[model samples]
Target: MKTLDFKPKLVSAIRNYNKQTFMADLMAGLIVGIVALPLAIAFGIASGVSPEKGIITAIVAGFAISALGGSKVQIGGPTGAFIVIVAGIINQYGIQGLTIATLMAGVFLIGFGLLRLGTIIKYIPYPIIVGFTSGIAVTIFTTQVKDLLGMQMDAVPSDFIEKWIAYFQNLTHIDPWSAGVGLVSVAIIASAPKFSKRIPGSLIAIIVMTVVVLLLKQYAGVTSIETIGDRFNISSQLPDAVVPELSWETIKGLVAPALTIAILGAIESLLSATVADGVIGDHHNSNTELIGQGVANIVSPIFGGIPATGAIARTMTNINNGGRTPIAGIVHAVVLLLIFLFLMPLAQYIPMACLAGVLVVVSYGMSGWRSFTALMHNPKSDITVLLLTFFLTIIFDLTVAIEVGIVCACLLFMKRMSETTDVKAVYDEIDLNEDADMERGNLEHLSIPKGVEVYEINGPYFFGAGNKFEDLMGGFGDRPKVRIIRMRKVPFIDSTGLHNLENMCLMSQKEGITVVLSGVNEKVEAVLRRNNFHKLLGQENICNHIDLALARANEIVG
Candidate 1:
């Protein structure tokens, strides 16, 4: 709660009114709006919706997120993370269902913020994050291949293998012009950084390719590919509001997709905020950001927009071009809105293949190839998680991939921790050496006398490692004269571990052998006192160290 406070001084320092900062913000906003143009349309089309909704989302949700969000430079809009979820909702429940689901997700996000669970969400494991992220990248790439190559399929299949099979069936009808354009677009976007740092490669590719496509359409009479106008009617007017049906039945149907959308949106938005923090050396209020996103989502859908969140690429573009405050993001939204009203007609000529080309570049950029390669050199368990998540996301679905990946990672981590826990026995053998400093007669060695045994336990004694205690103590065939348990290195113990220890003491007493404890740390001592282990084992037998326990053990044995 304390971490969520917004410092007025920090805000004033950044929000200082100046012509230089305002001009810089305006230019950055314009540039990011251009970068977002193709992506907005492509993401909408890819989600099986018309192009205008994506633009509206960028205008409405993007504006609200920046104006009211926690991060200063986060550029918000429709993101790839929401692609799988929105598509799934549209397929199962239709456009109306998708809207309702987005609204529900927004409400959930608002609740999440109010509960102040923002910081805790960071505890999600790194392997799980990478696994799902890489998986989504692969899926986005796979989904765009058909459009990029201009494959002549009536409807693209959603299943992974089936999608490829459909693509192969249409391989013979591939449009050379479209593929050439996509390849060119990829090349230009890929090489943008080498030549110019201010302008984005995707924006350049879109301009060049749109010109080329328009020329071919005018002179060649070769209409082999589709454009945004071909699929959906182009309209500059805001979509008419229609309330979606949301009875219990509709709510029940959309619950799963709604939850998935909420989770993905939360993760992507917060991660982008963190990245912006690293770039500008400032902190963000994650809970407040989430609440802002929720409000934007709730309102955007009513205006016929899709699920939206902070986009990493757009946010980075904002920072690189001198955007340093939330004002720049608001300016970006306004710029996009102005374009929608006055320039939407011109967008009709933007070919779907060109948009596809833009998405192909997006897919490539999202791949995180270096990070993927680095994970290959990680531990086997992590590698397994990476592969499992990647394959599951491609072959099955994103939701299942995340759920199973998290579970598998947790179980594997516990197994590794358990393996590091052990018990060992030690004997003082140095005194037997001839080079001992003490005289042979005077030199003394501690030994495990007959009918008495000792053991040392090390590491955390959680439920997983606690079972080993039974195995070690069970080795005694029957009650011995005395037994000592050492736990100097045991820093922590839980209820289950204490339960096992209590049972061990009871069994030893039942077998007529007194059990002694040695070398307990303050943490373990607290548990011992709370669980009454000292009372059960006897205070006299609970010695401070091994030597004391050994002496007491010898007396009992004698």
Candidate 2:
């Protein structure tokens, strides 16, 4: 196998990082940081952790991924994808467990990159990807209802259906003020781009909602809803690294969650990188990006951060705002760092409902509702794979969803491929065109010889399509006096396909009948020689085309 190689272009634009680009990146970074800030906090809280973890992830993991990653504009941080996994880890094993799992996941990512499995990851079926992605979106959206509506629930269960039931049971207790803030926040953030492109709607919404809540508190003295400070005390101190306890029992328990984190992180990060490539017209080194993300996840957990990956929305904002290099990603991280140190206290006043609203939008985007519905319009095989993966993701766990989805896709693909495999009687009508030759050809007027059969396979000879060859050969009521199997149309044959050919040859030999092959492409012929099928069936029987094989068949019969 030829090894996969990529040549990195190490061109420098630092000398030309003129004031214009710098200012653009600076502002873009700031805007993305603000957008990320509330998101980081909300994601962390949703994942069953404190607010600081999310910010720390944005600062530490975000910086590491951008500084070392392959893409020029990818923004890395805790995304909506990890909410369910993180929550499960935290619920089952605690924060220490989550940290250990994150670290282990990092190791897995690095190993995957080192093993050069980057290209193989792309083979993951589209239906499976959409299925779990849509499922994750729904899960995130459901998780935020309690916070968005200001419902008083001590703990939200992890099960999907149970959580919804819990939400509806508490529907009557919704706080009207918090609901109003969430709805307004959503509107302002959603409609911000219509008014101005430079400033993000989320930041504007946060400011507007925050100031409104502040004025209400100061003037109207309304105290119905909770804020970040009331839920978890805010601190301005820089987050410190905490060493995780790596006990045998903890490692054993964290293995599954760690694998889940690693797989989902790889999927989301690569997907985001691919999306960035399209937006910027640049290709990303997937293996290098995976390694970078691994390092980020590994290091961020030590600093009290959660699992992180390349964030698509943030990366898009960076690109739209003229952030054209990795420097922008680094700047974005630094911008968040400054906010964490200086503006942490101010963030306390940003209502929890505002954060919930931001995440609501995040969930909607991540859910990819448009694409999910679009997938329904695809082929039935694709629809089956999509719905299977989606429902499995919602009902069970993501790992299971992915496992089953891939398997289902593989089975469905084999089924389709098998359907494409056809055994045809090509005498007088190979192309099936309505032109001359078929009715007037010499062979067309010739009478069929008793106990002689001819069949042509017209596609790639892979296992799925290969097995059907036996059925075609067996379709003859009795063993033919001679059989000519034409394989000129088969571009290539895999091991299983060759094995089937050998079986057909052996069966013909046992019946004291001759089997001849015609139009064998060089690749398939090479496989036959390598498998010693040529010797078993005699090289004289194998010809370059159907005409030569028919001549040889005639000689054998005479």
Candidate 3:
């Protein structure tokens, strides 16, 4: 039985807990919490929910993930990746549906961890990952255009093309005051790092822009701009936990959205953990992290929070600020909760345009343009997967893009594998000796017993190569009394390859021929042994090298 390791990183960090580390974690957590405040709000609003929901996510989900997660510095909350899917869910099924779907996704994540599928999730192709990420960036940028430009649209279209068209049509309704606030917010966020690395640029932008917009409206009588207070009510209290009522029909409808949330959450969290590992020189338990994420998602939605995952930017912030343990993540969550309890009313004064500006900067960071451009010079298959995933994400949605990208990548990979796998007949020593004599070269002679044949197989013996092996074996007009298969270059075998081998063995046995396997690697031999293939072929028939196999074949022929 496989032993399951459910140990959280927090427990390990606590074992060596010291005052100095606590101070570092406290300060780092405070700074990260400040940085998370505006982003949480922005992601929530962009996801078609109230700004407080974002804060709720950061506080509730953030705390749970930190306390139970595998990574020390990972910060979990609502992120830009969820905006498109969340908005679609809200629009189609309403908030209740979204709640149920998020809950289902949480269950899925827990299952993923319990099944120990963490390593498998990391194998998703880089091109597909980049493609969807870049696509999400584009989608996020597009979604923020209305607020950034202060366009007077009642509602932005969910469709990508239609959304752009709506933006163009509403170009005349752009408010200069709102645009000014947004641009200044962007400028401050972009340049604030030069002044002080300790303070986040987005936090600075939020503070200064909010005060500026407030002063402009109160003293100068500017009425064109919109603030969070003007749009949505800022709740100062934590939401009560409530179970979403579900029916069979509702459950059926929500499965796809739930799956999308679970998959994206898993991918983003794992990626963030991996990045944090590089920064801190620590390995994270991926399965444990997934379980933590699952628990967070399950608990968060009950408190009016959306699906949450590890935020790469916030995790980096924690690391840069000297956060070395999960305590910092816990502190960050506590700080956000405090802000929600006390500073919630003040947040209402924050300008929507400024938040939009913050999201635009976020979109820029998530764009992955550098990686995407680099991939253009890669193989045509990779490039194709990237482009296809990108366009499909924009045209349809992430679900379709991910599905198509994975399928396409798999097919292309199989094609390459098949191309590498080959089966060729090994010529007898007589033929080689004849050619050597005619060529007049100092060549060693080789001899083979009559009614003995040899064949060589190269590359992995997987499903893709099964047909090639079958075709090569089928062309043999006459059956030899003894046959040797040279597999020195073969690395591994799959069920399909094993099945084909079994068929070959049965046929050879019926024809009174002995089949000898040569140079089978340890991995392949393990599989053969597990399937009792060696017993079928007889232990004496298996050899470590071609010479031994030839000798064994000679004995069999004799």
Candidate 4:
């Protein structure tokens, strides 16, 4: 393993910074900042926290991730992915507990980076990712139905089934004005891009709907709409940095939640970075990105921000708008800070129903329904993992769903690997005339010495296929003077497979029969060389092709 490098992409970007790049970054940053405002507020409200926490996350975490991260254009903040987890944590463990857990999660993320586990995390199965994401999208949509319909429910239940039950029970109390505003919000967001792509649809929807709600309440006597001002206090000032109180008991109890947060944060941030890399035609250092995320998480929560990670939508917005460096991300944070200072008061008028509309749109984009439906046509095992993860996330929680999904994927992978591996006799006669044009003449007419045999092992020789190799070799009935094992198709071998191969070699040596290995691929050859298995088999017995092995076998039995 190479020594870990802690360099941030910003350092390099700044060195090559030019006037043209600065202009692009500035405009992109401003646009993305505007795009992030409503989303940050909506994610916060949906996660059962005050709207300020989300904005704080966007400003503080977003800045840290960009300034110190490995990706040039990543925007970090509270995303919809964490809504379910954060809401559950806040409900079960109060704000204080959530703070402690988040802090611990930050420590875990830092550890993940220092330990160089970034590349490993990326290997997580795609089916599981899509499954949990779709599940979260469904859950987010479910939570918003009450607000969207403007149902008069005192408090929505956290349980998936019970929340819908409450919505249905309060269906008669739906406020038409609130629902109308929400519908208008969604419509504006959906259609605003056609008029202009420079401004985000969500922002337009929030602005138009807030004004409409205010006007209707004043003149038309429609007053059932709930705005941010009615729900939580909107503060223009930044929050003070404070550490949460910690104890051994609290730390022990929070370990699980903390790990859950760390894992999800790492996965989402790296995934977002990978997407950004594709857009910019650059490769990001995964380990360095994880370290940057760790630092952001650690610092953001000190200012009363919720758990934050790379926000995919906002990052894409930045990329599409010409953000090519970390400066763009830094500028985005600054823009949000300006909004918090000057425009916070106006935000109070933004309707809860409108925020709900924004979340509904977010959930729909995240649902990945097309991918989910397309996966239905995949193999049964993949479909099983996808559906199991999806249902488990909704019925239980993300932690359970992810754990089970990985386990299922692993087992299925092992089964498929074992099925692909095979050990069988090579009974076909070679045609010498067919390969006359080749450098190595065909050994089709080459006569096999008496009491000599050939066998082929195909696919990867891992623990899953080791037993098959042993069983097939053990099934040989008659004693042979020489046995050639053809490994042309075997690309790699794990420790167990190597051990089994060693056992076969030792048994053949004891039985006074020469074991010749043929057509060993580079990877398999490296393993054999590293383990000194070639010496044990006698270097003269190893061959590059079956013809050489046959020649060696004939010489041995001559």
Q: Which has the greatest lDDT? A: 3
Q: For model 2, which pairs clash?
A: 451-481
Candidate 4's residue-wise lDDT over 1-558, tens digit each?
777767899999999899999999999999999999999999989999999889999999999999989899999999999998898888889888888888888888888888889999999888999999999999999999988878887888788999888888888999898899888899999998899888999999998998899899899988799899998999889889999878999999888788888888999999999999998999898888888998888898899999999989899999999999999999999999999999988889999999999999999999999999999999999999999999999988888898899999999998898889888765435444543222354334545566787777878887666566556665556788998888888888998888888888888889998999988878788889999987898788878877788888889888
Two-way TM-score contest, 1 vs 4, winner: 4
Alpha-carbon runs more than 4 Å astray in model 2: 1-20, 247-255, 426-450, 474-478
Can you give the lDDT of residue 537 in candidate 2?
Answer: 85
CA lDDT, every model vs. true structure: 0.81, 0.81, 0.89, 0.88
lDDT accuracy of residue 287 in candidate 4: 83
Residue-wise C-alpha lDDT for candidate 1, range 1-558, written one tens digit per residue: 255432222255365678888888888998888878778878988877888899999999998888778888889999887776677678877899899999999998888887777787776777777878877877888888887888777888879899888888889988888787777888888888899887778778878888888888899986875776777888899877676867998888777778778777888899999998998999888888888888888988999999999999999999999988777887888888888999987777777777777777777677787888899999999999988988898888887887888789889988897787787654433232432222345546545677777777778776666567666666766557887887777889888778777777787798898988877778788888887777788788887776677778888888
**Candidate 3 regions with alpha-carbon error over 4 angstroms:** 430-445, 449-452, 470-482, 502-516, 521-545, 552-558
Give the worst 10-residue stretch by lDDT in candidate 2. Answer: 4-13
Candidate 4's C-alpha runs over 4 A off are 428-442, 470-482, 502-516, 519-558
Task: Report per-prediction Cα RMSD to one decimal.
Answer: 4.2, 3.3, 4.1, 3.2
Give the clashing residue pairs of candidate 1, or none.
Answer: none
lDDT of 4 at 354: 97
RMSD of 2: 3.3
